[model samples]
Target: MSAINFTDVVFQTPRRVCHSIWDGLPGAITQTRAMRRLGRYIYRRFTRHTVRTQSHYTQFMRNPPLLDVLARLLSEYQIGSTVKLASIGCSTGAELYSALYVLRRARPDLKILATGVDISSEVIKAAERGIYCPGQSAATNGLYLEGRPELFWEDAKALRDLFEVQHGGTLRVQDRLRKDTNWLTADATEGGLADTLGPQNIVLANNVMGPMDDSLAEVCLRNVMNLVEPGGYLVVDGIDLDLKTRVLATSDFKPVLLGQEELWSADGSKDGWPWVRWGREPLDRTEPTWELRYSIIFQHARV
Candidate 1:
């Protein structure tokens, strides 16, 4: 019994097991047609554990409200030269690219340095390539596995100036836009942000830790925080309210509300375009906090 392989019973389909046996059996054993039929059975069991997330496009939300806040900050501070920005969990580089586009549009004279980091290598590569197509390249890496196809079309339209669709149905980002974008692979749960990516003026740690347990999320949140420079901006839009409250209880940086303290945002720029914001002000880190107040104006807080 110890010699028997149980992969067939546990997960692999019957056809997969049969093919394995057929190849392993001695050449003297005749391969029967019945064996082939049995090998073709196509059912397999799935693991109960949740699968890892795939990288996805930002649904062409190239105009995130976060950009508006950052712009206001930059202008207020009179930032003349280079501005460093990092997108934590930058799935497929959409968010990072969007930031770059905004900076270039708002402050063309300033040089924009952007880095994108994600846990999934597949998604990182996709982000690096900076290419997409509704029919072919959109789902190339299995991202947006459950989202509808029409959404890609809508996103493409929203970001038309940034990318061009080829005759063969592949979308390519403009070379000018792709020049300054850098891609990195790292996990926030592990504290390598310092070595992998040095401190940044602004860090976007969005959409990763919110779903996890508080203890685990805290560890990951610290990892993300490590990437932010002193007095710098860190966007924690993905964390749950409870986790945010607990984690910020000890930190010196204030909590900035993005999109009225909601998971998703809308700035009313377009019918479907989503927007983001950053609001933060604490009476005292050691003292209690106050109620949620939405504000569009972001004062220049240069780190």
Candidate 2:
């Protein structure tokens, strides 16, 4: 080959490869993107395989802002009335139970029909069981509260009492909560999700489809939104920003504000005294220790 031809061939080969990679950047489906997506899928698949020892991800007081919004909603919806609540992807029932316990504490007379759903039968059964290790409670409730407890201690205690802590600290949720809350297994991605369960006054789908494809997430969210009763609330924190933006851009839905720091203050100020963080990681103890509090408490505009 001639000298110039040889040089051209070397440079041309790389340019084609570079062009191919850059091309994938813009389109929905690219070879590079597909491979990376497949890698992630495989990793998750394997991680799920070791479920026997894996700690199902969870957080304490996942979002206090939702509680604040709920409190406000109650006052406006009705001074004392029956409200329906549904927690999608309720995973082991922590979030579902938390909502029920907190709301019931606020309005002792208000009747709440709560539903908890997930895709995994084992997890649903575990949720139905309503049991958690002691460490689980301390991480969510203990560290987040840090030094303050009097304000929330009563409600926390009421919930803790509902558990029958047996030998080895396997806490079982008592009949009081289990009787009122229904647990089931259902896929959110399908159209049947709405028909399977009727409308709800408050629908929580947080941390459910975060790991799924954005397109799939959007579809599931839309289906879930349809199930919300008119003027009802929907919470989906785990969703992607793109999906949220597109979803909110529509006239049908409006984004709900999160109190954040406002939730911890006496008057609920975003720039206030009480923060949802701790100065130091405290040692383990019998009581729960709350160091870092929950992240954004997402909400949805009533339609």
Q: Candidate 2: how large is its RMSD?
A: 14.8
lDDT of 1 by residue, 1-303 (tens): 221344445345554454465457653442344332222221111221124333343444534666766765566335577777888877766677777777678887777788988777777887888877664334245434423231266567777877878887667778877877788877778766777888787787765664465677789878877777765777665454445666565665664554433323342321210011111121122223432112221112435
- The superposed Cα distance between candidate 2 and the true structure at residue 253, in angstroms, equals 1.7
Q: What's model 1's lDDT at 120?
A: 70
Clashing pairs in 1: 15-39, 65-276, 255-280, 256-279, 257-279
Q: List the residue pairs that clash in candidate 2.
A: 60-140, 142-288, 142-289, 142-290, 143-289, 143-290, 143-291, 144-290, 144-291
Model 2 regions lying over 4 Å from their true place: 1-56, 136-162, 258-303
Model 2 TM-score is 0.61
Q: Give all candidates' CA lDDT scores.
A: 0.56, 0.56
User: What range of 10 consecutive residues in model 1 has the weakest lDDT sum?
Assistant: 270-279
Q: TM-score of every model?
A: 0.65, 0.61
- Root-mean-square deviation per candidate: 16.5, 14.8
